[model samples]
Target: MSARSLRQVTLLTVVLLLGASLGLALSLRVWPVSCPEAEPYQLGRTGRCVWAAWAADAYVVDGDLEQARERVSALGAQAADTVCSLAVGDCATCRGGQAEAGADLAAALGLACPDGVEGAP
Candidate 1:
C-alpha cells in the first residue's frame, strides 16, 4: 500500500479505538453500583445502603448507638436523617420508657411489635 494510504488507515484505527475506549469508560462510570449478595439491606436511590431497621430500633430503645452508627456511617448524616424522618414520624412521645419505646420503634420500622406492647402503633 502507498505510505499515504497506510498512514490514513493507521490514524483511522487509532481514532476509532480512542472513541470506543472513551465510550466504555463513560458507561462504566454512569452505571449504578450494587450491593454484594451477602448484604441483606436495600440500597437507597443514591446507591447507598439504608440502615437496618433492627439497628435503629436498638439504638432508640437500648441506647445501643454503636451498631446503629456503624451501619448509618455509610449513609452520612443527611441521608440518615432523611431515612429516619421517613421511617419514624412524630416518634418522640414513645421515649417515655424503654419497653414502650422499643415496641414503638419496631412498629415504625414496619416490624410486628409484640402483642400488648404499650405505645406501639
Candidate 2:
C-alpha cells in the first residue's frame, strides 16, 4: 500500500484498539450473592445488581411471581433494618423511630412509588 494509506490504516487501528481497551476497562462488573434486591436496579447502578437473588431463585424454582412476592415480602423488615443500620449506624433509638414512622407513613399512603406509576403525564 502507499505510505499515506498505510499511515491512515495504522492510525485507524490504534484508535479502534484504544477505544476497545477503554470500553473493556469500564465495562460493568458484578458479583452475585445472598442478598435482597435493591428496589429497581437498572443501568448506571453500581455493579447493576438486579432482583433479589433469593426471590429470583424462588421464582425460578416455583415458576410463579406469587412465590417470589411471598418470599421477598418476608424480608421487608430485614431490608428496612439494614437500611437503617447503614444510615444511622450505632445511633440512638429516636432516629430509628423516626425512620420507622416515616416508612409507616409512606406505606399508609397506599400509593405506588413513582417508578411503579405508568403512562405519560
Candidate 3:
C-alpha cells in the first residue's frame, strides 16, 4: 500500500481501538449495573470490613448518594457488630481500625465518618 493509505489505515485503527475501549468502560460504569442487595461483608482479622465497599461504586454510578452513604453506614454497623461478637467480653477494646475504615469508606460515600459512637461491651 502507498504511505498515504498506510497512514490512513493506522489512524482508522487507532480510532476504532479508542472507541471500543471507551465503549467497554462505559458499559461497566453506566447505570443498570448489577449491584448487590446488601454489602456482603466479613470482618477481617485486621478489623477491616472487607466486602462492605462493594456498593459504593455502583451507587455512585447510579447517582444515588444517599444509597452510597447508607451502604457505608451499614458497613460501619457490620464492622462494629463483628467487633462485638469476636470480643471475649469488652467489645470496646476490639473495635479496631474501623475508625480508619470509616474514614476511608466515608470518602467513597461522599461524607465523613461520624464519631462518638464507639466503645461497646
Task: Tell me the tens digit of each residue's lDDT in model 1 across 1-121.
Answer: 9999999999999999999999998876676455455432333434443335435655655666565555555545654543343343323222234334444554443443334544444
lDDT of 2 by residue, 23-107 (tens): 7766634432322333322212233322442243346356564554455456665433332222222223222243333233223
Candidate 3 RMSD to the correct structure: 14.5
Error of 2 at 68 (Å): 11
lDDT of 3 by residue, 1-121 (tens): 9999999999999999999999998876553333233543333333333454445546756778688767756777763344233322222322344444444444545442234323321
Q: What is the alpha-carbon lDDT of model 2 when measured against the actual structure?
A: 0.39
Q: What lDDT score goes with residue 6 in model 2?
A: 98
Q: Score candidate 3 by lDDT.
A: 0.49
Of the two candidates 2 and 3, the one with more favorable lDDT, higher being better, is 3
Candidate 2 ranges with C-alpha deviation above 4 Å: 27-45, 51-57, 60-121
Q: Higher TM-score: candidate 1 or 2?
A: 1
Please report, in order, the local distance difference test score of every candidate based on alpha carbons.
0.50, 0.39, 0.49
- TM-score of predicted model 1? 0.33
**Model 3: runs farther than 4 Å from truth?**
31-112, 115-121
Return the clash pairs for model 2, or none: none
Which stretches of candidate 1 lie above 4 Å from their native place?
40-121
